[model samples]
Target: MQTSPQAIFFDVNETLLDLQPVKESVAAALGGSKELVPLWFTTLLQYSLVSTVGGRYADFGSIATAALQMVARQQGMEFSEAAAKAAVKPVRSLPPHPEVPAALERLNAAGFLLYTLTNSAADALEDQMTHSGLKGYFAGRLSVDGVQKFKPHRDVYTWAAEQVGADPKDCLLVAAHGWDVAGAGWAGMQTAFIARPGQVTYPLADAPDHTFPDLDRLADALTMR
Candidate 1:
């Protein structure tokens, strides 16, 4: 991101918190196979985009539940709501990625207001951060549920800026997801993409001003003052 952003918005799920446990849980629940996990996640994101473009609204957890069930049916696997909840239970108690804390501290110390913006349900987000001992780092958190639109939609990024009391231009979005960065960049916010292993940016999207393999490096690059 550019120097001195007035506020920084973070994408929560795989960006700050680790989701491997949830993936593992889902994989185990689905006949001890891991292949369906990726498909389910990808489908979840696609369905989220569908809801956003269709102008329909659903909480993230609800959408996730439905998506899981749909995937299970397609795979001819039995997945009850109870089972699905069990599989996804790890989300509430996920640990932060190893590089996250120090990076956040650097940004906080550099005098940037920090906030979380995620597709997760608002209440679930609070629980996730509190459970992971990361609740205090951010000044605030917002959710797609609030606007009934998902990230990569210009409305979400611009609305997030308004919530943080800054123009989109003065806000920088930090995320591991290419689509999130692309959306924020298109919304006129500076964006930095954290290239977590196994993740890639949308190739057709605008190039981010900064790309780091991890948060610690990103912190060093942007907040070295």
Candidate 2:
């Protein structure tokens, strides 16, 4: 069993905040059904991995735009820059999922330091967090821009650990993405997987320390730890 951590670093996007609005926006922009949103999201992540492997980096928004265009092209639809921009706009306005606020409050009341680590640009992350009523819960927001790399990268996790002045072993990385948790675990940090539906688990080589269905469960487990 692991000891209670001094700090908890969370992943934004689908982890705490619901992406349904953004998904709906993308569907409307693409003239496709809402089901297509997951397809677009998957494509976006695939490109991020490709860019990382190729030693190239693009901001998350830029990547989202490109991925949208590609998804449009795949559907034999001409991409609309305006629609693409509109599709991504909801990202900055997404609200937290039902369990987020209460879970955050619980963790905060327990005296755990909370922070955010996201692939989003700082400006965008600030807007999203502030609008979601979750702004005050975090000590700071750590964007991938600082490291010029995306999640699953060791440097990004290490950078976050250093930023908050916490030891990797004493910090618990919490994210809905298995890859994010796996990467943090690989970086020597404890990890909790927030198992959002439809997301895949990472390979065993990159598995997280624990998996919970949502933030509430994670908070409860942390308290017990």
Candidate 3:
């Protein structure tokens, strides 16, 4: 079995926080078609990478709004920038997954330094943490905006490790996204994949050091470790 990590960095969206509210908002903007919600989110992630690869930086909120507009175009609907922005606004107030608070408490009490590493801007991350009531459990928050690159990027993972003053190998990146886990692994950090519903590891990527159905299970395993 592997030893415990010195610190843990969490991915914010769809990992600690539920994305249902934001997906509902996006669905409303897309004429009540829930199916289009995933398209918008995937488009947002795609364009974020485009921004990074092209050496340009745009805040995630702006990218979300733009991606919503793109989805509207795909469906032959006209979407106003203001309307799209409104749809993406609920992201700032998403609720934490039911098990997140208790799990975080367990991790914190176990003496692991907990921090958030996310693509959201600093202010946005603050709003999310405060709104979700998960703020007090964390010791700090790190945002990719600080380095103008999004997660799954090598620089972003390495940068976050440095921010926590931990060697990459000593840090554990706990994320619901397979891509995030893969990136952290590629960056030389330990990884725990929180297999949130519908999320799976990429077949070609190295397996995560730990895989659990939820954070509660992860906490149980970690404390035992």
Best by TM-score: 3
lDDT (Cα atoms) of all candidates against the true structure: 0.87, 0.86, 0.92
**TM-score of each candidate?**
0.96, 0.94, 0.98
Off by over 4 Å in 2: none
Tens digit per residue, CA lDDT, model 3, 44-141: 99999999999999999999999999999999999799999999999999999999999999989999899999999889999999999999998988
lDDT of 2 by residue, 177-207 (tens): 8788888998989988888898767778556
Clash count for each candidate, listed in order shown: 0, 0, 0
A best-first ranking of the candidates according to their TM-score comes to 3, 1, 2
Ranking by lDDT: 3, 1, 2
On lDDT, the candidate that comes out on top is 3
